[model samples]
Target: EDKVVQSPLSLVVHEGDTVTLNCSYEVTNFRSLLWYKQEKKAPTFLFMLTSSGIEKKSGRLSSILDKKELFSILNITATQTGDSAIYLCAVFNSGNTGKLIFGQGTTLQVKP
Candidate 1:
């Protein structure tokens, strides 16, 4: 079975500090690494890294994938109160059937 786990379940930081969220996974026949930000009813897609040499970036957030290590990291620079949200990492399983396996998630709180 494929599984994902994230550390430091919750975090609190000031508006100007940067934060790095970690996600590790164990899976068979990986396909893609995905990141999402959750604040509302549904999560919003942040990045998807498939190619080995490419990194996904959006504004102050960025993520990288390492197929060999079966893990990914998300970095946020100069966070703001509006940036507070739960970060999730999911792996897309590739085989006969497709499925999304997600980590528990990391909650980030940025204060003014």
Candidate 2:
């Protein structure tokens, strides 16, 4: 079965700390990788990476995909208390179903 795994299931850091979150996967007919951040409401789209080695960025958050290694990393620099949330990683297969296989997610707590 296709699966995705995230490391350091949970993390706690003081404000201004930089963090690296990992996501690895094993799937058939890989298509793209996606990252999301969930707060009080819903998961918010962060980045979608299709090409390996290309880093996608938004504000202090950035992510890169390494297809050959079957993994991806999300980096957050100078994090703030507002950055506390659940970070999710998901992948889409090349199949026509358009369904995304998701990992359990990494919960982050940024203290002030």
Candidate 3:
């Protein structure tokens, strides 16, 4: 079965801490790695990393995928209360599009 796992299940930050979120996976034939941020309802897309070390960044958020190691990482700098949300890691299969298979997610709590 293709599955994703994220570490440090939850986090607590005080309005300026830089945080790194880790995600690791095991799949029969990996295709892509995706990141999402959840505040309410469904998660909003963050990054889709297919190459290693090459980070995709926007504002205070950045992410990278390491296909060699079968893992990915997300970094958030200068976190604010607005940044508080759940981070989810997902894998996309070229053959499947039913819905995104989800990890339990890493909940981020940024205190003001």
Candidate 4:
């Protein structure tokens, strides 16, 4: 069975602070590692890492994969209160089943 683990299950930070979140996984026939942010009921896709040594970035957020180590990291810079949310990491197989094995998620609270 595929599994994902996220470190620092929860975090509290003030505006302008930067944070780093981590995810590690063990899976058979791993296809990709995906990052998502959840503010409400739905989760919004942030990045999908299929190749190692590639960093994906969007505005104040960025993520990178280390396939050799079977891990990934997510970074948030100049954090605002709006950045408060639950960040999730998931892994799925290469069989194209559209099934994802999700991590417990990291809850971030950004306060002004």
Highest lDDT: give the candidate number: 2
Query: Residue by residue across 1-112, what tens digits does model 4's lDDT show?
Result: 6789999899999999999999999988888999999998899999999999989999999999999999999999999999999999998876657578899999999999
List TM-scores for all candidates, in order: 0.94, 0.97, 0.92, 0.95
Q: Write the per-residue lDDT of candidate 3 for residues 1-111, one digit (tens) a residue.
A: 778899889999899999999999887556788999999878998888877889899999999888888889999999999999999999876655534566889999999
List all candidate RMSDs to the true structure: 1.0, 0.8, 1.5, 1.3
> How far does residue 105 in candidate 3 sit from its true spot (Å)?
0.3
> What are the Cα lDDT values of the candidates?
0.89, 0.95, 0.88, 0.94
Q: After superposition, how far is residue 112 of candidate 3 from its true place, in Å?
A: 1.0
Candidate 2 TM-score versus the reference? 0.97
lDDT of 4 at 5: 98
Worst 10 residues of 1 by lDDT: 48-57
How do the residues 1-112 of candidate 1 rate in per-residue lDDT, one tens digit apiece?
A: 7899986799999999999999898977788889999996699999988876577888999888877777788999999999998998998889777888899999999999
Lowest summed lDDT across 10 adjacent residues in model 2 is found at 91-100
* Model 3 spans > 4 angstroms off: 95-99
Which of 2 and 3 is the better model by lDDT?
A: 2
